[model samples]
Target: DAMVIQNPRYQVTQFGKPVTLSCSQTLNHNVMYWYQQKSSQAPKLLFHYYDKDFNNEADTPDNFQSRRPNTSFCFLDIRSPGLGDAAMYLCATSRDSRWQTYEQYFGPGTRLTVT
Candidate 1:
């Protein structure tokens, strides 16, 4: 069974403060995800990694950072979270990146609130 776990399902931080959100998977899927979803908009892929290879979206801002130390873990770090940075940070995993179509297992997400 594929399952994703995200710690601190709800997080609150002050403006310009730094925060880190973690995601871990038990199935050890090769592809780990770090994306942002604001309100009703679709989840935007900030960056992702399969093992050690990473791919960052061209439009992703520098303030958003991601790290994957091993196959099972990933982290999203916001250097200086602004008011607009408050959003639902979602973590997901898939088998691999080569497939044309694949299903992703998603964590419940960590909702970041900035005040």
Candidate 2:
């Protein structure tokens, strides 16, 4: 089935080390988003790309960055992996229709473990 896919479902990194997580989709959607979710906390919107136009959430930290080289792929780079940064990183895709509605399809998510 055409859907989002995340690589390295489980990642182990040392604190202060750099790590990258990747996401790809086969749906060919115009919008792609990255979210960080911690245990018992709501998923936080980190950033997104709308057909090459990158949008980063204002509250997102400087340590968190994303890159969408093309429509089918996106990457999340954690400049420095901290203990608190250990969490599930999710990638999603959506298309906004003229009807003013959007439905997002999410990937299984990449879990980062920082030591």
List, in order, the clash count of every candidate structure. 0, 0
What does candidate 1's lDDT look like per residue over 12-97, in tens digits? Answer: 99999899999999987888889899999999999988778989999999999999988889999999999989999999998875
Instruction: Identify the runs in model 2 with alpha carbons over 4 angstroms from their true place.
Output: 97-99
Off by over 4 Å in 1: 97-101
lDDT of 2 by residue, 29-79 (tens): 999999999999998999998889999999999999988998899999999
Candidate 2's TM-score reads: 0.95
Q: 17, model 2: CA deviation in Å?
A: 0.8
**Sequence-dependent TM-score of model 1:** 0.93
Residue pairs in collision within model 1 = none
lDDT against true structure, model 2: 0.94
